[model samples]
Target: MKKQLTAIFISLLFFQLSISAVEPMKPQEFKADIIIYGGTSAAITAAVQATRMKKTVIIVSPDRHLGGLSASGLGFTDTGNKGVIGGLAREFYHRVYLHYQDKQSWPWQQQTEYGNKGQGTPAIDGTDRTMWIFEPHVAEQIMEDFVKENTLKIYRDELLNRESGVLMKNGNILAITTLSGKKFIGKVFIDTTYEGDLMAAAKVSYHVGREANTTYGENWNGVQTLVFQHQHHFATKIDPYKIPGDKKSGLLAGISNETPSPNGTADDKLQAYCFRMCLTNVPENRVAFPKPDRYNLLDYELLVRVFNSGWKALFNKYDPLPNRKTDTNNHGPFSTDYIGMNYDYPEASYQRRKEIIAAHENYQKGLMYFMATDPRIPKDLQQQLNTWGLAKDEFKDNGNWPHQIYVREARRMIGAFVMSENEVLGKKEVPKPIGMGSYSLDSHHTQRYVTPEGYVQNEGDIGVKAPKPYGISYNAIVPKITECKNLLVPICISSSHIAYGSVRMEPVFMILGESAATAASLAIDNRTAVQEVNYNQLKTLLLKQKQTLNWNGKP
Candidate 1:
């Protein structure tokens, strides 16, 4: 009996020790000259530039991976003008080129067989020594190389305590604490998150959703009900009700019941989010699309209706990447984009955001599964979809699915200066140019609702071409001098909704990241606010760094 009791006591003691090992983390402190929040392409470039400038920087990332959408299946880059991309951004693509130069990089397909597939542009720019199109893993590897080469300090999986994280004094951030009880003190901070969490936490001014076209005197700033630039809209009229023509059957699974704001009006709606899936038709490297656990036939009723009505543009945007893989993005209406589902994501708590992200993942997975296996789909389309599957080697960590969701737009900062349509279209000359954007002003559909004509329609999809490469102002990055003196936002920049569509490219983010870091370092050295950095000196240093501040209207 005594032996038995002693054994139980020993087991209990061991269990207690195990519990202590998993106890809540105690607060720990770290100090750095510059602290960057968000593990994005912008964040990585910012840290790399700061390190090169001889400043101690730490990346307080709330992610396990470093790169954002760039490493997360956005391999088919959307560069409008390769000439405008320079500095660290161009270096990243050059590294991608070097990676492909090694013959061994071609695993599923030979380099010659893949040929040069890009969006009406050469994949490899010979003169620049940069390759714009690449595989998702290849992009991630390049970003990993940057972190490894710099030996930069990155605190992965450390989320900021949004409620009471930032400690500020006299218009300066003193320290920021993460939810895991890690506190980082820094002289200057940069927020490179797509969601602008750090900037929002610092009480910086920002705007979410779309602004009225009149607010900025921009043609593509708001509700674009009449604009149908892409073929993403429904090809024909499809009923949104669950029971086809019966309104009493209630609305379909994905269709919203709310009335859309008038054309060119502002609303709280945000663009749809999706996983830019990396898929492949190569048999050896393909993993069949798995039906999600929560798959419901009722959820995809609207899609079936569209298919039944003779929609055949489902595979339009399967953009080709290296290694026989494709960057499968949202193409037609009722596709991968989970419309009207992510409106609350910008300000959602971590746990809530996780739920939103998971929902998006499930939605996309179910979409692929339905396309491949659902008998309701046209037999020809089903057969074609069955030929493709998720790339087995890509996103291996998360069941062969992309780990990042495409946050097309989020909380845009309302800083000292906001880039508007006039500046983007070369109507107004921007002062103190730090970078340039040439991509067309593009905003994805924000809502899918029933139209007054008793048909389902998408709203808020806008695409307006910029006349030429335009300068991005330094003031667009830094907060108002009175709001925060030490912070810079690169990803969620201060811009009108229409202008952000042009400036939110990954290359532009990296360019702005480098410039922001350079400005931060100068500010720290000169003992001045980010807004007070001399533009002439900043411009000189940027030019010295080989950054392209203006386009000479040449390819």
Candidate 2:
């Protein structure tokens, strides 16, 4: 009987050990020729190009969903000069065209009902077989289809262990371990995240915030409180004090009490961030904007004052998308952009970043709720806002809200050649052209401060147009040879603040992403560092892939 009891106890212990082994997660080990460390549109294009070049690639993304801003609420694509977008970037838009061609793709509205209304151009380019604008879900589906068709390996919800994630050997990244203990080993790596997290972890040289105008000989680089080119500025003088005229009553919330920075000087303040909300007017497909859990009326007292002071351009940027939806963005002085609240985001811990993201969501949602329901708002404006609601079919997993917030600018790699405003404005020639960017050098407000006259004013809003489609050099996307040998930074390419404003567009990012992957493939073939890749050979391959390296004056 004693022997039998001992046998039973041993059997139970073995069973318990087996169960524990299965329950606890072990570090997943993966190896590939190339590792792309972001889920942005640029990352997707890079992975696709690598696959096309017949190289093994894996995407380790911090995001649960793929396609960063493209899959987010930025459905109104910002394609500056359509002719300049090519290669896999153009292919992605062509796929969007194909998706819309099918009648089954339109569920909420008919194809005919939604006419061509894009960013000052037709939505569909029949000759090129590309569509510039699309719904959020459609973009997500296209990216998923790319992964399925190519059979690419993707690890989602995996964040980089920023402290000790990157393992380097002689300036080459050998492996990167995630917070979850997943280890990804690769021959070549690409950092395509908006925040340049992987690049920063790899000890690559980068810059954060706006550089001085004199730093790169650019006029739109630093503080611009005096230049109010857009209508987002204050139309009338309004008191910045909480008690209307009494300075002793203290400043109102969200208004900075500090003096403006001297123009043409560097500052650490980053551009504001906001959600490009996907809204719809269709009753069946609309979800009313929910009142955020931490909603506070006092937070928006300034906006109420703005409305009372004759600011009526609330719906200036409700850009249309397919299926009766709108890509609503920050418009007037106080809108979606959470001003002066994201200065620490670029270097914040993951937990802290999550809190910031939540705060932005809450603030924007509360703003929408205030505009639609608050009694202080003008009745006409309130009625107009009431017509729009979150698209029910979009972002189903995230309570009918966008899963990713718009990170307009983040850590920019200080690479071999830093593209500045001169290059973008066609005043300087770029060597070994790989891509092009033609968007206006645009920036949103950085802070709201009280003018010397005691009136509230916004600072750091500038929009200077690029002269034409300008070449982005190969050196811009590559790190310095001394910093890292095998890494490429496409999304956060080396550029001054003013030049980055034009290059930060989604199409431009995708274009550079494809170019970066091409360079990576060439480096792998030659067994050389990414910085040493032959520009002539790289240019040949890029042209063969149908990438537009120059404008060619087609229009």
Q: Can you list the residue pairs that collide in candidate 1?
A: none
Prediction RMSDs, each to the true structure: 3.3, 2.1
The TM-score that candidate 2 achieves is: 0.97
- Writing each residue's lDDT as its tens digit, candidate 1 over 307-391 gives 8898888888999898889988888888899999999999898899999999988888888888788888998888988899999
* TM-score of candidate 1 to 2 decimals: 0.95
Clashes of 2: 0
| lDDT of candidate 2 over 370-438, digit per residue (tens) | 888989999998998898999999999999899899999989999999999999999899998999888
> How many steric clashes between backbone atoms does each model show?
0, 0
